[model samples]
Target: MDFNFTEEQDMVRDGLSRMVREQYGPEERRQLIASDAGWSKAIWGQLAELGILGMSFSEEDGGFGGGAIDSMVIMEEFGKGLVVEPFVPTVVCAGGFLKHAGTAAQKEEHIGGIVSGERVFAFAYAEPRGRYDLANIETTAKKDGGDYVLNGHKAVVIGAPWASHLVVTARTGGERTDAQGISVFVVDKSADGIVTRDYATVDGRRASEVYFENVRVPADALIGEEGNALPLIERVTDEAIAAQCAEACGAMKVAHAMTLDYAKQRKQFGVPIASFQVLQHRMVDMYTEYECSVSMTYLATLRLDADERTRKEAVSAAKVRVAQAAHHVGQEAIQIHGGNGMTDEYAIGHYFKRLTIFDSEFGNIDHHMKRHIALAS
Candidate 1:
């Protein structure tokens, strides 16, 4: 199968690439993350103007009618600049849910704001006790008169502080950890009885520990059928994993490039360190890992529409390889950069931190390895 991008896809990538180079330099990104908002609303508006926020939705949903490959293109660029925006949360995760299963009214109400960049969304799914298990929900949504009252805490909700709404998961009927009874809702973040304690993460993005205390949402807020949303959740998350793997590939590419440039510039024994054959071999190894990751990411993204078992197996397998590449490239970049790489002022270290945290997102290396094994079985 052909892996080349279409002309439109190439155009979107080149435009976004130029935008990242001009607008989000390393210094600009560093400062943006340091600010209280921890991201740039101005840049978000720029993305809206460029029609990126809507790139992955259907035309009926006020989008340009893009798909997972579109998201992969956009996210790879976002990763290069280490953008701290809520693209993954708002566009990939929440948008995936709406595009796949939302009611017409839900799409009409939410997708417009999202495409226009007037709204941001965070995915509040993982609990303090839930370690990578999508069905392990301790939060509950109980049926009330014409509404569902949500009560539970979501831990490490990425981008929550900046979100206007949340795509949240909760148990609606069956016991915790059961595949049945897990439901999803679109909740207004500022609703009564909702609380958030936000902080900066090691990777320069923001996250929150969010609590829902008797927060009532209209029945219309439900994204899919109650107690039967796990399959939908899995599908969306697999799509997300594809996008995220592309992002990691972008990060690895930049990290390896930076190390190569540093080696060419830094001198030892009156010659560039790059002149040394041993270091050259290491750099080559890093490049190889990055390329391998790119191929695996492509595999995952392409297989998203396959059967459930096929899709899950491909995503998990890709994630395992990509995570390993991220770790190897990140460590090598730092090692090649030596003492300077360890400084917070340098951008390579920041890249390293992002790559490190990337391993834990969606699922870790071991987690995906086990998942792939289970699918194989």
Candidate 2:
């Protein structure tokens, strides 16, 4: 199979690369992170104008009809820049759910805002006790006269503080861990009885702990058939896992390159460290891990449209491999940079922080390993 990108995809990648290189230097990134919103609205608008935000959805949904590969390209570039934008939460997670499970009218109502960057979105699914289980939801949405009243707490909702809308999961029927009786609902972030406590994440992004105390939403707020959203949730979560792995691959590439550059410049014992054979071997190991990660990410991207079992297995495998690479590449990058790598002023440390966070998002290495084993056996 040809892993080569199409001309359009290449253009997209090049365009984003140029945007980040020219507009998002380390100091500029710091300023953006320190800003009240914790991200750059100008850059967000630029992405919308460039059509990057719409690249992952279908034309009927007012997008470019691009799929997993499109998201892979955009996210990898974003990773290289340490972009603090909510693209993953807004476009990948929430938009993926909308595209896969939303009704035509629902798609028409919300997708344009995402494509135009006029509205930010977030997926509020992770509960305080969920621990990577999609079905482990304690949030409940009880029917109440043409509406549903939601009540529960969502933990670490990335981008929620800035999001105008949220796609939330709630239990409508059975127990917390049951596959059935789960549903997805879209709620306005400013709705009555909704509360959020926002904070800056370690990786320079913003997330919030949101609470719903009898939050009421109209009947039209439901995304798909009630009590049957787990499959859609699972499929979209796998896509998110694949997208994040690709992002890690991009970060790993940058980390490896930066470490090599540092080795060439920093002298030790009156000689450049790159000249040391032992250090060279370590850099080589980092490069090998990066290469393997990229290959696995590509494989997972291609398998997104495969059968459910195959897709899940491929995604899990890629997540596990990429998680390992994140650790190895990040640590080696830090080691090569010495104590300077630990400081917030340097870019290397930020990359390492992002990689560390990437290890836990969606699923960690051990989590994916267990998932792959369960599916295979």
- Prediction RMSDs, each to the true structure: 0.7, 0.8
Q: What is the TM-score of each candidate against the true structure?
A: 0.99, 0.99
lDDT of 1 by residue, 176-212 (tens): 9999999999999999999999999999999999999
Q: What TM-score does prediction 2 earn?
A: 0.99
Over 1-377, each residue of candidate 2 has an lDDT whose tens digit, in order, gives 88889999999999999999899888899888899979878888999999999999999899998989999999899888888888888899889888988888889889999999998998999988998899999999999999999999999999888899999999999998999999999999999999999999999999999999999999999988899999899888898888888888888988999999999999989999999999999999999999999999999989999999999999999999899989999998999899999998989999999999998888788888999999999
| Global lDDT scores for all candidate models | 0.94, 0.92
Q: Which 10 consecutive positions of candidate 2 have the poorest summed lDDT?
A: 359-368
TM value for model 1: 0.99
Please list all clashing residue pairs in model 2, or write none if there are none: none
